[model samples]
Target chain A: MHRQFSLQPFSRHYSHSTHPFLDFLDFDGSEPTSAGEPSAAAHIVVRPAERAQLLDVLAAYKDAQNAGTLLTLTFVTVNDYLWLLRAVSQELSQLGRSCLYYLAAAVSDFFLPRQRMSEHKIQSGKGSLHIEMDQVPKILKPLVAEWTREGYIVSFKLETDEALLVPKARQALARYGHQVVIGNDLHRRKFEVVFVSPKASAPRADQGESVPGEHYEESWLRIDLEQHPQKEIEEDIVSELVKRHQAWIAAASAASA
Target chain B: MHRQFSLQPFSRHYSHSTHPFLDFLDFDGSEPTSAGEPSAAAHIVVRPAERAQLLDVLAAYKDAQNAGTLLTLTFVTVNDYLWLLRAVSQELSQLGRSCLYYLAAAVSDFFLPRQRMSEHKIQSGKGSLHIEMDQVPKILKPLVAEWTREGYIVSFKLETDEALLVPKARQALARYGHQVVIGNDLHRRKFEVVFVSPKASAPRADQGESVPGEHYEESWLRIDLEQHPQKEIEEDIVSELVKRHQAWIAAASAASA
Candidate 1:
């Protein structure tokens, strides 16, 4: 008998006036302003710290998902983003498909708190973190297993706390049955990346044949879905879901033993 | 001087995709249910042609103006329910201490296309009209006069017919000195409304009270302005604008004047 990951759904309801702490925004991908002026708030919000932020991001993502966006979900707070990663994984598992997706939580942990954040000058202490990271739900593991059980495919993210990214990715494949796991150095706003898949052991494979990830239109997706009438956007989301499911089913069955 | 309504000042771009149509949906608000039937949708959609059913009622009370709503404006369209009037005049004009609370149009003549409309059980003849009814822009006259030239406030809705609402509204009041004209009706879903203003109105004395007119929610006014972020079922449009502009206006000036 195969074991599985069980996920419980949670929603954070904010009061009329208060906002969740975890709702702070991220400066990454944001255009910085000229010196000696207030920072421009173009995609620049504080990282979210409370439960409400998670719900807000979830609501935004849900609205987008329902509206047919294939974009990866983005958030400000490291903790909430991590939590969301697990949530998405658990949701996928509950639907009888395991997720093999990457979540770089330790990434945000490196950033200093907002009160201590200074853009111009780097913080001095050059201190190393002796972090006591608690156990996060390894949603990716169970998700990938669930997908395998139902004959599906999935992928995830990884950042090196270990010696080699390739070995780490292979270990993940052996344990969770993920076809691929993207590994990285966990730095901010950089373009360098690495992809690790079960097929990585085969060099003669169609390694260069991988297509680039498609990017989403920021301004278009940046809308407050609640502000627009329901039809056009809603129909778009439905069409995207159907398309993805059909493609995923085809790809997984053909590749599976 | 043989003058017309003052032209509205051009301003920054505005996006007003009022979600009220979606939010107030009873898609199946009422469950015309049968045994073992599925739940009716919580949304309601009415089409452009069907709006004639609602307009028939509003035209009945056109002359009776002072509905005495405690609220300031009338966010009403023709045949709007008695509860949602927004005394639009109250926001732009006043005689020192009195508010000319009335409504103007930023309303839609054509509504969302409908699927099924109710059959008319009228005890009348070809009471049906192939109505090419151009929705008259409500309150275009007075709102444009005082607010536009001196401190204008008026509104209008334009079609490919651009709007005759403002000019017609101004002529109705025997003055064109309004500051703003809300122009909109078709060709755009949101942000189509423009605030147009015309010159001042000549002062009148010995004003007499007019009989009461029925009122309702100005879905049309809310369409371009309040429809953004979404439409609230309980909010009155006139009072909302007053809070934004500090005018001590009447509840319905034209009816009582």
Candidate 2:
């Protein structure tokens, strides 16, 4: 069975500046280029190295397609994320495929439900715009318990303060019992992430000695791309994840045999 | 005095899909192109017609810049809109510029105070992320009355519900005593807008005949760009606003003379 896991970026906008793949598209040249109905300056000018890199990428894509590998890309908007997640879970279960859900979208913590929202635009002439939004029901618990069980799951914990990253990540791991929780700081998220897993051994051996089988595991993955800014952290992240998944698959097969 | 007015697009992300002049940069093509460090398949591929359109844009930009015209591009982020507005007001006042403030940004109604936020990431194990944001203090009053008094301020009223557009727009015009308020629905904002002002006559004769001086002055502008989707609504907006401002200037000059 195809690993049945896919990587999807769920955010308000389909294309963003920080997206690893799209980041390459943010060209800095004297001219701009347009594909159809050119409105803006559509001139494409790139340095030699950048052109070579793009050609390499196109070649790789061609190779993958020719090999008959499926590349499924799904775009999720903020308004539809909750409903879409449930639907995806049900679909994956029916197909008997283990899924890996990567939660990376910056969702609104609270929102004005459709029914409570004003029928017309709120008037600014009244002086101040006082909007009281209801807290969105927490979706993680239900997501873990009800959908995509027997599948691996990965979620992100992002905070402005670096000190709170590990503690919060571990807490999420314990609470959700998911496969992995990546903890990162907002400012440094692009460069670093600490993977938290329940199966990992405690960094400090003596700390969890009396806690029965409860041992928090943490693995730090950092990439300094100062010299090579074009290099992405995803390269390392994907490689590490693949290794872990392969090991897990081997162990499962051995047990079954 | 350079008409001393500026149109600011206030949103979390400054450069978006709709800033009229910025629209020229939104090109369409099969492949993406990067100026440097191309990561994904960013090849600049476009048809011959698109190339001609881009050259036209470059020529226009060169002409404007060579003519010694000042085209200020002020980008304001979510956290900085208020401060930037104040700063712009002071700058224009000092220069004795008659400014036109066109406020058309999707601003957040509430925000978490910096002091109240957690030093580190909030732990997820505690269950449920409850964020209590304080209502943003209304700054439009001081903006009009104190900061930019000699300027012509035209604000925008965007509502999701069509019914609330006109009432709210008129209320803002009366309440603030500003020059004008353009009312638009979120979905059709690009193509349709109702300009509400104290000077203009009622749209239809009998609609406001009963009211003594309470006659509503509203002008509906709707452009159907079905065949020419690339055509922007801002072109008309700028032209109309320029006509009104010129008349205002002539009146001011006659009074002094």
Top candidate on lDDT is 2
Per-model lDDT: 0.35, 0.59
Per-residue lDDT value at A230 in model 1: 37
Q: TM-score, B chain, candidate 1?
A: 0.28
Q: Which candidate leads in TM-score? A: 2
TM-score of each: 0.24, 0.68
Candidate 2 lDDT at B61 equals 45
Local error of candidate 2 at A63, Å? 6.4
Model 1, DockQ value? 0.01
> Which residue segments of model 1 deviate by more than 4 Å?
A1-257, B1-105, B109-152, B157-257
lDDT of 1 at B125: 20
